[model samples]
Target: MPGSPPNAPCSMRASICALTCWCSDDTRPIRSATPRSSMRSGRARSSRPRPRSPRKNGSPRPGPHASRPRASRSTARTGPGRSKSGSPAGPCGSIRSSPPRSGPRNGRAGDCQSPARGYPRGMSAPVAVALEPCSTGENPLWHAGENALYWTDIPAGKLFRFDPADGIYRKVYEGEPVGGFTVQADGSLLLFRVSDFARFDPATGSLSILRTFRDEGMQRFNDVMADPEGRVFAGTIGTDDRGGGLYRVDTDGTVTRLFRGTRVSNGMGFTPDLRRMYWTDSTAKTISVFEYDRATGSLANPAIVHAAGPADGTPDGMVVDAEGNLWSARWDGHAILKIAPDGTVLERHAFPVAKVSALCFAGPDLDQFYVTTAGGGRPESQPLDGALFHLATGTRGPDRFRSRILL
Candidate 1:
C-alpha cells in the first residue's frame, strides 16, 4: 500500500492484474512480464508468477490475445480510424493518450495482480462510437422506459439521447454542466446539475431545481445510480481537484448526505438484490462497497471493492450485469473493466480511445452495451474525438432505474 501512490499506474504485474492492460485486443495477453518497481519509486515488491490456465490447443498459453498483432504504444490508435497525429479519437472526443501514467489506485496495492487480470477468462470488447467530439462526456444511462440512451457532457452543459432502435441520436437538453443522473419509477429523471439535485421532464423539455448543497458550491454532480426500491444516489466532485462526496435523494424530495472526502467520485451500482452498493473514487483509484438494508435504506459494512493504479486508468461510470459483474468505464486507461463481485477483475476490454466514460446495457434483451467517452477531457478540435460507442458483450444487464417524476 505504501509503494502504490494515489495517482500512478501500478507496476507491470500489478498493471496486468489491477489494469489488465493488454497491448492491443482485450483477448490477448502481454508477451512478457516486466519487473515491478522498475518504472517508478515506491513500487510494490516482486511476487511469484500467476498460474495461467491451459490454452485451447493444449499448447503453453501465449500472451494475451495472441491472435492479434501488437500495436506500438506510441501509435495510440486502437479502433477503426486514426488521426494525422496518430492518436485515435476516443469514444467521447479528441483526447489523445498521454505518456503512460504511473500511480496507485487508492494509494495502495499488495499481491492483487493475478486475480485482477480477469477471472473466468473472457474479455468484453467495446465498440467505439462514431459521433462529433464532446467537451467532457461522463455519465451514461440506459432508459429502458423509453428504450433510449441518455448521457451528459460535463463541460459542454449538454445532455444527449440516443435511440438504438432506430440508430438516431439527439441532443435533448442543455443544462448547467450536469455530472450524473438517474431515472425514477414515475418516468421523470433526477439529475445532479451544478450544486444540487434537480428534476428533468423529457416530455415537456423542462428542468426544475429540487435540492441544493450550496456549501458544496464548487462541487458538481459526477456519477449517479438508483437502488431497487427507487432511491436515487449521486456523487459530486469539487472543481480543480479539491474533493468530492456522495449523496442520496429519496422519492419524497429529501436529500441526504451519505459519504464524503472522496476525490472524484466516479462509478456506482447496486447489487442484483439491492442489498449492496458499490462506488468509485477516481482520483483515489479505488472502488468501495457498502451493505444496504433494503427496508431502512441505510448503508453499513463499508469495504474495498477494487482499486486500480494510474496505469489501469481512473474508474468512471459503471453498470451491473445480470450476472452481478460490474463493468466500469476507464478514464485514461483506454479500457472498460469488468470485475467480479469478490473484487477480482474478470476482464479488460480495450477501447480505441484512451478515455471511456460511462456504459449501459441497451437492446431488447439488455445485452448490447453503449459506452460514452470524452476527448481527453478537453474541447474537440480533431475528427471523431467524441463519438457514441457500441459493444456487444453478449451479457444481459439489470433493469433500467427510472426516476419517479414528482411533477
Candidate 2:
C-alpha cells in the first residue's frame, strides 16, 4: 500500500502475487513471526513506480531483513583455517593466539603469529625438562663423552649438569656468576667466572684460580669457546672505564687481546673448514663474520653478516651445524633461525617462551637439540620461561672438541 503505482489498485490479489514472486527467490530461511505486509513490501511496486521517502544520498530505505540476526561473534570464521578470534589449532592440537601487545616484554618481542605451516614432518613440539628452572640460563653444552648435558644460570651463580642415562640433575658448582665454561680434556671444567677465570675439578671439588681480572675494568666475561687447537676465545663486557674486548687465552694461560670497543660480546662459532668465524654483539644487535686463521688464532677482514632490527630481537648464543650452517638463538624473537653460510635465512623454529637464549645439539647421535631460556626480569610468567627444552632434529651435529688448554 505504501509504494503502489498511481494507476494500479492497491488490492490484496495483486499484492499477494507480487509478494509471492519476491518471496520465492529469497534463499534465507524465513522467520516465523515475519508479517505478510513486510513480504509484500520487498517487491517492486511497478515498472514506473515513484521512489518514496528517498534519503539524502538517494539510497533505498533498509528492508525488513536488514535487522536479521547475525552469526555469533564467537562462531564467525575469519579466514580459511583461522577462527574469529584469530587463534588456530597448533601442531600439538592446542589453541594458540597472539593477543595485541605494545612493545618488547623482557627483552623479547610479543608472541608471534601461528608457526609457519611447513615444520619438518614428524617433528613434535619441544619438550621441557622437569628440572628446576633457572633465573637466566645460558650456554647449553652437550658432552658426548660423558653422555651428559651442562649449562649455567648466570644470575643464580650456579652450574648444572644432567645425565640422561639415569635422569638425574645435579649442581656442579655454586659461587660467583659463571658466564661461560668449557669441558677440559681430563673431564675437569675451565670456568669463566664474574671477575676471573678458574679451574674446577669435579672429582675433588677443588677450585683453583687460573687468572684474575680484578683491575682490568671489565664487568665480567660473557661467552667463551675453545678452538680445535685448544686456544680459548673469550669476550668481556666492559665496566665504567672500558669497553668490551675479545681475548684469546692460549694453552699456557696467556690472554691476548684480539679485538676491543664492543659493548656486549656473546656467542661464537667456527665454520667446518675453520676458515671463518662468527661472533655476536648483543648490544649492537649484529652477527659478524671474520676471516679466521685457526692455526694462529687470528681474526681479520671483519664484516657484518646479519643485523637484527628493532622487532627481530637480539642474537645471543650460536652453534655451527655439520653442513656449516649457523643456528642462532634469538633472545626475544621467540625462535631459532638457521642461517646459511652466506647469511640467508634457511629455516626458523618457534618456541613457546619469548626469551630463547641458547641451544646445542645433544644425544649419542647428536640429533637432539637442547635449548635454554631466561626468566629474570619478566612481568608475567610463561609456561616454559626458564626451562630446558629438547626437540628431535633428525640431523647430526659435529662432535664438541674438548678445550685442550692446560690448567
Candidate 3:
C-alpha cells in the first residue's frame, strides 16, 4: 500500500509512501445501551495492524453491490417491518445473494417507518427519503446557503451537489478524488485531492492547487470542515493507513500542520458555540475533541471524545446540529448516533445499510437529514448497496460550515 512503512507507528512518513492512497471505511461503533460505561468487552490486542480484507486487496476492486434504477415511490408510508414471506426483514428488504432485478421499490418489503412514525424504541428504522446511487459515496455535507447537499465519491473521483429546490443535481467536479470539501466565502469550494488542497470553481471549470500535505505528497485528503472564522481544517490518509495528518489551511493559501499520525481521518465539525473542534480517526475507532481559539484558528487541550465499540462500528463522518448535539455515521454499526456534547450517545437510529459514510441536514426547514451510506469494501452480495438515504429527524444542524475566505 502507498504511504505506509512496515512496523511504523503512523508517523509523518511510511515506507510505502509511493503507493496510491486507499479510501475505505473500517470504523467500529459503540452500540451498548450504557453511556460512559464500557459494556462490550473482550478485545484482544494485536501488535500488527488489522489485515486488509482479501476481497479489497489488489489494484482496488470495484464496489461489489449494484443498485436498482430510480423508482418513484410514495414517501408517506414505509410499510411494516415484515417481509412478504412472513419473516422478520433485515434492514434491507430481502437479503438475496443477487441484486434486486428492479431498482429499490418504495413499499414496505423490510421497510420500517421513520422515528416520526413511532414504531417503538429500537424498532423504528431509518427511511431513505432521498438517494444518490453513486458507488463508494463517502463524505456528506449539507450546504444551507445553497439549500443543497454536497458529498464526494472518492473512488469515482467526483464531487456532487444536490439542490433540493427542484430536486436537481449536478456533478461539480470530476477526475479529482475529492473526499471532503468546505465552502469558501465566495461560494467556491476548497477540496483536497490526493494530498493537495485546491480551490475548485464549480462555476468556471478550474482547479487551482494550493499546497501538498502528508506522506510527502503520497496521501489524499479524506475529510474536512471550516470553522466560524473561515479556516479550513482537514485530514489525510495513505494507502496503508500510515502517515495521515490533520491540517489547517488559511484563507491566504498558507497551510499548517496541526496534528500528524492520523489513520484515515474521517468526520469533522465544530461545536455549536464554536468553542471546540471534534474529529474522528476511522480505522482507530477514536474520536478526539480539541479546545479551539477562534481568534487565531488554533487548537489546544486535545482529548479523546469517544472511542467507539470494536464490533459495533467505527466513526466515519460527523456533524453537530443546532441543538449542540453531535451526530456521527457509524460505518459498520448500520446506524447514525446522536451524541451529547460530553460524548454521551443520546440516541441511535439504525439504517438498513451498514456502511453509513457521512451525513447532512436539508429539506425546506433544514430539519430533514440526508445520509450517504457506502457498501464498505466490496459491493454487498445483495443489491441496493451504495444507495443514498434520507430521514426527517425534525432537527436542525448548526449553521452551515462557514466557508474560509479564499485569497
TM-scores of the models, in the order given = 0.68, 0.69, 0.68
**Per-residue C-alpha lDDT of model 2 across residues 96-151, encoded as one tens digit per residue:** 11211221112121221111124443232354542234678898888766777788
TM-score of 1: 0.68
Ranking of models by TM-score: 2, 3, 1
Please write out the lDDT profile of model 1 over residues 268-355, one tens digit for every residue: 7788877888888887788888998877668898898788865788888888888889888888887787789988876677666777
For candidate 3, the TM-score is 0.68
lDDT of each: 0.62, 0.66, 0.62
RMSD of each: 14.4, 22.7, 16.8
Best by lDDT: 2
lDDT of 3 by residue, 237-338 (tens): 856656677888887767788877656888887887788888888878888899999899899998987878665488988888888888898887878888
True-structure lDDT of candidate 1: 0.62
Q: How far is candidate 3 from the true structure (C-alpha RMSD, Å)?
A: 16.8
Model 1 residue 276 CA deviation (Å) reads 1.1
Candidate 2: lDDT over CA atoms? 0.66
